[model samples]
Target: MTLPVEAGLHRSCCLIDTASLSHNISVLKKGLAPGAEIAAVVKSNAYGHGVRIAWRAFVEGGATWLCVDSLHEAQELRDDGYTGNLFVMGHIPPAHAKTAVSLDVRCMVYDRRQIDALGEAANAASRPLRLVMKLETGTQRQGLTIEAALNLAHYIARFPYLVLEGTATHFANIEDTTDHSFAYEQLRIFNEYNDILTANGFRPTLRTIANSAAGILWPHTHCELVRAGITCYGMWPSTECYVSARLLGKDVDLRPALTWKTLIAQIKTVPAGSLIGYGCTYETTHESRIAVLPVGYYDGYDRAMSNLAYVLIRGKRAPVRGRICMNMCMVDVTDIPDAEPGDDVVLLGRQGGESLSAEQLATWAGTINYELTTQIQTNIPRIAV
Candidate 1:
């Protein structure tokens, strides 16, 4: 939504608190044993917090490595001057092996074709491409079976140009339930796979099987490196993750580092019995003052939050009225006397003592905080606080 210059300045922006980011890193580090490293997962533009800014915060906070979803993301980090250990945790197409090897980015390998391509690329470039083999431990996603993993390790040993530097796995339900029986089972299977690999003379230097939830709740799973994703961004993976942490006596003090703000595009008075916004879903029973916001579903402000959510203006809660439009929505600011056009509007952050958290918005939108924060349109300017 377009706005006047004054309103545009505040219409939409995300503020990243570097101090809070560092605090989270410290919290995660406290749980790790000596020699265990933290690989900050900075994929999806640092979960929509701006990769360039957040990755720097992570590096300055002493992150040992950076994990991203794609080769492009790794290139972005390199282009932005991040010279730390960068690994692509997600799939890298066989075609991008040359670029990946040239850029010195580690990649996860699951298929023989990928390994062959990467080995060829590394041979051609005269540079060893580090690889992490993902073990299939019930996730059923991108991973190799125990037998396949062992075979791949044997196959990789023949390639002098390809180095199997690590072995990893993804937990399917570690964050969903407090009863981590399934996760423990997955870990057991992962260990069995590792044992087989080691038995076959394929001992990887680094072994990681913990995501944010496992890293926080199960310290034993933090083998050589822990990949901290949502938690590093000051967000809990799930309610169960928080509970599991407390139950395990690993109470971490995580402060959210992002604050999304907008501005009131227009302020108008609506008479009683007037319909508001799309679908005529909301009817004003009394004379009300409404503040228009230059943000909606298009900006990752879920359309489902149209009638269920509220924004903060002038330190007061302003309930959203009616259906949310593509680029705008209206909040009932009748109780907020000082709210007017160009007034600061908090979409997902604190305003004075009132705050709108990602978790709260996730509830209102019938989703999770990860989806809420990660879905924020990347085009919106992110400023460091």
Candidate 2:
């Protein structure tokens, strides 16, 4: 289904392939045990593929649960008529506890101060509030110590309105390097904490600690549930993740679901030695044909991509010229003589025989694919193709 492009949109939009999403889901499922639940993390607008669009795709692709970064994101999915389990995997302000409870969204909790408010909200709503306890294994981001988690679990058990439904942790170095020793150590620590919880008679319905990288590379880490984030969208967590999967002989296929495209807003010719864009970072070495694209840093095309990236125009690569501005950038389309204003430009997908992968764009921009996709402005229309 093609989404309508609204008037005044920059003509730069994303196309999400639901078939590819389904394919990725199937790949993830094959690596899991039977009846293992899969939670598709749809935070940051489903990595800026548009949550509303990607949310439906994930559900249709067989995600048993949807994970979001905030209560508002979960609410957005609920408002859109998604009836599956919604896990708010990030912190929600205590003030929004009542609303979160009403929405029946499961929240990840690490703070003790939030308990009373959440319990009160759940009681007021006459429903149990589900929560996941994040254990501080090694990432040290948003997790509690084992003792603290035990205390919180006991505290949560005391409140009839609160249900400690899960326990989770994050791996710090699973995706950055081929060596997974650190990740294994983190897993060992997590298992110790899980043992404590189990011995204390706090059996969470879900015991999960694997993100996309770990989920894909480490089979033993797949517990009762696996929170598939980047991989679900058909992007690897990192090259290391792909390497690890191959080394482990895991035949996993991930199809990229997002295709970023824009139109050539204008075409112009510049004489040799003419400078292009801000600060005159690049000069035309020869008489050059330039295609102006209405996409720039403001639209999530990183400014660092200036003079370093290429977009597909007329089935050929058009190297970016000069600096990427807030609202536009220029691409040398001299090689593609047929390229003209209103011609479709491929920024992050295949065009004819050429393709631009997110990894390629990320390398040029000095960032990662996760940031590239998540940084895309939510205002950009994402059509499910």
TM-score per candidate: 0.97, 0.97
**What lDDT tens digits, residue by residue, belong to model 1 across residues 31-65?**
88677899999999899899988998888788889
Q: Which 10-residue span in candidate 1 carries the lowest summed lDDT?
A: 1-10
Angstrom error at residue 352, model 2 = 0.5
Residue pairs in candidate 1 whose N, alpha carbon or C atoms collide under 3 angstroms:
none
For candidate 2, what is the lDDT? 0.88
**In model 1, how large is the Cα lDDT of residue 122?**
91
lDDT of 2 by residue, 1-385 (tens): 1214642445688888888987888788888865577889999999878888887878777888889999888889999999888888888888988988889988889987788889988888789888999999889799999999999998888788999988999899999999889889999999999888989999777888888987788778988888999999899999888988899888788899888988888999999999999999999989999889999999999999999999988788999999999989999988888877888888999989999999999999999999999998888888888
The list of candidate 1 runs beyond 4 A from truth reads: 1-10
